[model samples]
Target chain A: MNALWKVARFTATDIFRSKWLPVYTVFFFLIAEGLFRFSGDSGQALVSLTNITILLIPAASIIYGALYFYGAREFIELLLAQPVGRKPLFTGLFSGIAGALGGGFLIGTGLPCLLHGTADDRITILAILSIGVMLTLIFVALALLVAVRSDEKVRGVGICLGLWLAFAILYDGLIWLVLALFADYPLERAAIVMTTLNPIDLGRVGIMLRLDIAALMGYTGAVFEQFFGSRVGFTLTSGAMLAWIVAPFMLALRSFSRKDF
Target chain B: MPPHDMGRHCSSLEMMSAAAGQILRLLLLFSICFACMRTSAVHAAEVRVGNGVDFAAAVAKAAAGDRIIVPNGVHTAIDVKIDKPLEITGQAGATLDGKGKSQILIISAGNVVIRGLTFIRSGMSYVSDNAAIKATGISDLKIENCSFRDNFFGIYLAKSSNCIVRNCSFKASGRLESSSGNGIHQWYCRNSVIENNTIAGHRDGIYLEFSRNAIIRGNKSLNNIRYGLHFMFSDSCAYRDNLFQENGAGVAVMYSKFITMTGNIFRQNWGPAAYGLLLKEIADSHIERNRIEGNTTGLYADGCNRNTIHFNTFHRNGWGVKIYANSSQNNFKDNNFLSNTFAVSTNSSSLQTNVFDANYWSEYTGYDLNRDGFGDAAHHPVRLFTILIERQPTSLILLRSLFIDLLDAAERALPVLTPQTLADAHPRMKPKQ
Candidate 1:
């Protein structure tokens, strides 16, 4: 436990002192602030602003987490050479990164929402932070995995970018193609499966649904409406999203533990 | 022998009489056929009538199912009343000149088919719904391959069901606000299909009120005075594969239910009050597969519930999605948020009964080292910066300021005020693969 604390302390210290992390965090904050200000009285404007902020903050958090994880790995390796076990070292590194990310999130996004928010917006504000926290943990875990897997920085960044492209662009294009080619058959079933598989979309949809702009999210939620337009279907979709959150997390954790690195 | 021969002559006489009767019948048939041919030749629906008999008079003489073939030419006329089901076929280049006085055609009968006619310069009336073609109480009415220019409502469908308007173009006259007309207006109608039409320069490209079970597909609507497609009190309608661009308020889906909008493009719709698709008092609707780009607000949804938004791309919009208060029980999933100024914003955040899950946000900065492809933790999307921006519009000038950036970083470190409820329970490490 003491060794774990040391590892966590080391990670937190490194992240806290990093020059670039703050820059990125602040950059995200500014954009989020700008969007919130410009977002108007219309439901569309408000939803759009929230969506944009959600997208950007996670991206920023993930990127920073990746870099921080790798950067902190070298220090951990040195510590390992001294006498620390792999588990303690790894746990400490993750804890430290997670803490730093959590801190960055609170400072960059949480504070502003609190200071300027209405009594009614309290839940939305909490939702925003919750998303940020989840993303911070996710990135921390992912960064650790990447750091353990490869010594080369390029590969790690490449892998992350490739994943982003697939989730953001290729997946939807594929869904569209399938839908067009199989017009005779119902694609809603297939679409729901695909959506659950895409965690990014899951997160986005989950957050937007909470914000009550799911109606405007459009096609993303159509699959649920098709089978789940009924009460039973709605409950099923809700359950499916909940499963999406849990299943992937478990899988990621298992992979992290078993990875050779 | 003489008697028998006389009997044979009588029998032959009877046969001859029978042959005479058959010949008379044949002659009658031949005369009828000849008259039909002559009638067709005289009023050849394909014959150009620019200098010929009055087109209206020719139409009056047309038979119940004959073609009023207007050949490739121009004719100036007013008010061609169609009381019967007839094919009014115009040659490839034919034009009808309305002379800017009255409606070009008024169809009040069933199964009327109007095709391949270019109507120009119809009179505009503020008091009357003067249209190039006004179809009322008509069933199976088809208006195809036609053009209406400088008219009030190009084609009006009133209490008409199963009416099809396809491959048509409308350019409504730039009249004053009260005088401006809708491109295609349908009221109290059902089972109508408006497909593959281009409409511009009017209060609304397509307006449907109290209509139901309609399909608006494959249309291009642009530069309208109010909305590209405006609907009120409509239900069970589907809009797909359409483009709404550069319009005043884009498209307003208001006071409606059970609508499905898919595979449409909403772009360049700019104005203070502009939105790509607006939802008010909408329920049990499915809005999917739309490309909402470069609009003031990609989607503005309020007073809505039990709707699903999925698989959409919101790119480079001024504001991507807005949620007003009094909206609940909706779901947003599997969407792509790319390079928008504001992705999602909402008021009445306490009513946090909505769900947003499994969407790809370009701003997501997470990793999926495990190949299972999910972020290890939750992601809080609402930031203090966004909240500040929502509260203070003028504070946007400080967007790039170092102090604001520092403050944002501080907030991220320890979330204090941002909505605790605004988060993805599971944010994907990457987008969907």
Candidate 2:
């Protein structure tokens, strides 16, 4: 555990000094402030900021994770020559990347929402921010999994971008098609399960349920409310998010341990 | 139906018994006073009922145009059938208890007046629809300044014409929809006036069925189990300056023609199938100057035609207006749509039938270079995301997301996905004050 912390601290410092996280923070700050000024309502601003988070957070995390992993190849090789175990090195790298991204997102978007939003809106904003953080971690782990499997840098980046595209855009399209095709059947439970398969959808739905916009959703929104409105549903969704985070990281760790220096 | 008729018959019998008791008491009081007042100048025609008086017997013995005065006390439910023009007035604190078995007062004669009475505990049978005050086949009747509590129906006008019900309050705690009746129920009545009444906790606050030429104004109807004010097959009616709040679903105007609804307020009617006002199968109506706020849907119209909606404000609702495919010829002009999730949503892509012009939409962003108080470009109220979510409601999880916004913006720039003709040609530059 001590060695893991040491390696994590070292990698976090290296990533922090590169100044890429500042760029991410500034990007979010400008978007949030601009939305706040234009929309003229705190709730509307939160809604727009939530949209930005859902789209850009996953893409940014995946691309940044793959690039940072490839850029730190020499450092990783040097660490492999040390007395450090492979497991700790992989854990340190994953935590360092996820922490930096999550921290940047919080400071950038979350702070503005808290400052501008009313007291009643605090819980909803915090819930949305936490979902953003979870998406960051899940996508970073998936990116690492793609990085460890592929040998060439071009192949790794392609796979990372493809994964992001598939999860963020294509998955919803496929769900729409399936729902339309088999609309005769009772596919509510199946639809919910499909959403959990995509971490982005899970995060989106998790925050929407909190926003109380389910009344506009018609029937399916009612179904989701009945499922996710309860404590059991909340626990199940949170567990699914945790599984999404851990499963990819474990797979990436196994492959990294087996790879040749 | 036979069972319902039987229940009505039984309730009438109970009312007769109560009237008989009041009459017996009145006779005893008259006998005691007969010995003291032997002046022969006493007007024996005028029947006065004080404490422990037989009110039913007095009504039976009186002729037309006689006045019956009831002093302050508790009286039995008097179910006297009036065949003459009479006035029944109660003093302060006069109460009539129905004992939860029969109708409190039933008037079948014309030119009757009943005022200043508290009626309570009418029978609760769904078959009978027992009411505190039931007027049938009576013309030119006046019922005012009455309070009703825990009755199956508060004031019922059946097959009556030219009646006035004003300045009354009704309250009923109904646990189920099927078992409860409306506060002021009018069936087959014509030219009646219902105004300045407050009603709560009934199936419907004020219900009109097959009634025509009725005027409903300045009433507060709130927290009812169903609609605040519901109209069905009621034509040529006008309701103005009424307040409907927190009902199951706000006022529903259906199957009506030539109706005028103006200056009403609808608020806080939030539910899955709830709306501020529902206009179904209505035609040639005018809905103007209404305020609808904090509802699931501000106005939901289906199968409506040729209605004019003007100067209404829809604020902070889930959807400002959801018009189904069958509706047409509805003109929405000079209205304000503010802070709703979707300004207008329709099932079909055709916008040729309805007109949306000169309306102020908060989401409109076109320039007004001509300075005529109208935008230079047309404003499209329907979004592609709205159409998608209408098809698949679960897509609402992507509400306000960037991808949806991008798609909306792209669709706005190029009229490819959304309905091309569903644009307001004369969108107002500023909201109507």
* The best candidate in terms of lDDT: 2
Chain A TM-score of each model, in the order shown? 0.76, 0.96
After superposition, candidate 1 runs with Cα above 4 Å error: A1-261, B1-51, B173-176, B410-417
Error of 1 at B55 (Å): 1.8
Cα lDDT tens digits for candidate 1, B1-433: 2345545667777766766776677666775878643333223254235556667876787766667778777776688898877788888888888887888888888878889999887677867888888888878899899988888778889999999999999987584657778899999998999999999998899999999999999999999988999999999999999999988778998899999999999987765578888899999999898999877678888899999998888876656788775778788887777656567777644537777788766556566666665565555566565566565332332232233445666887787766566666666554443
Docking class of 1: incorrect
Candidate RMSDs in order: 20.0, 11.2
- Among all candidates shown, the one with the greatest TM-score: 2
Report the alpha-carbon TM-score of model 1 versus the true structure. Answer: 0.57
Q: What is the TM-score of each candidate against the true structure?
A: 0.57, 0.81
Model 2's alpha-carbon lDDT is 0.84
